[model samples]
Target: MSESLLAALLALLVVPALLAIHAGDLLLATLTLGGYGFAMALTWAALGAVDVAFTEAVVGAGATTVLMLAALLRTTRRRSPLPGRLRWAALLVVGTVGLALGAVTAALPPWGDPDTPAAVHVSPRYLTSAVAETATPNVVTAVLADYRSYDTLIETVVIVTAGLGCWLLLGPRSR
Candidate 1:
């Protein structure tokens, strides 16, 4: 992708995130978060991680937005105002964390740099040995199901647990 298009997608992510943060109405904030998630999905797609992009679109934009809307339907639309001091303190903490994360990103290797540790060490082994070792034709399948099975299983469990929690909280009362 062209630099301009990628920059625009990244900028799109920031705008909705800021809007969601400042939105007074809970519904508006939820919708804005969905927009942010969609922008994130697009950014991931542009970065050539289609699997991650699709997952983000479905879970982040689709399921999360729907769940928030359902929860809002069960209760209120307007957000309770935070005290001024509390708001300022929260902003300060968030800003500090954001700056720290940005600094960490700056210290990382460049995107897709071939000399990075993963590219230099791990990826070649996976590409060469995955099928033979795991008996899975697709390298990605072998990695996810065989090499990183526990991680994948835990991620699935987390998603399922979150869904179950939402359903228990938002489902109809057992009258």
Candidate 2:
């Protein structure tokens, strides 16, 4: 995808995210949050991160959204409005953090640069020995499921635990 198109799509992602954060209705916020995740997944795929996009779609948008809705079913409170001063303070803090992060990112090596750490070290090893080391024909599968198994397993455990916790919190109480 063209950079301009990716930028446009990412810009759309931010609008839904802002609305989700500010939504007065918890249900609406949850749904909007799912949309935001889906947009992020799309952005990831466009940036040539298919594995990340798949994980985002499955866990971020799908499982997390379902878990949030299930958790919402156990809740009495809907909207908790923040005070004006606090909201402004939050906005200021978020803006400052975002700007700082952006500056740090801008200072990083350009994407796909041969001298970058991953390019210099990780890629060469993976490309040369992935199949021999992992016995996996596909390099990505080898890296994700074999070489990075612990990381992937931890991520799965966290998502499953969160979903299960929400499921357990479902009310059986009689009013």
* TM-scores for the candidates: 0.80, 0.80
Query: Model 2, residue 2: what's the lDDT?
Result: 92
Worst 10 residues of 2 by lDDT: 166-175
**What lDDT would each prediction earn against the true structure?**
0.88, 0.87
Model 1 collision count:
0
| TM-score, cand. 2 | 0.80
**Model 1: how far is 57 from its true place, Å?**
1.3
Query: Per-residue lDDT of 43-68 in model 2, one digit per residue for the tens?
Result: 99998889889999998999899979
Deviation of model 2 at 15, angstroms: 1.2
Alpha-carbon runs more than 4 Å astray in model 1:
134-138, 154-156, 159-175
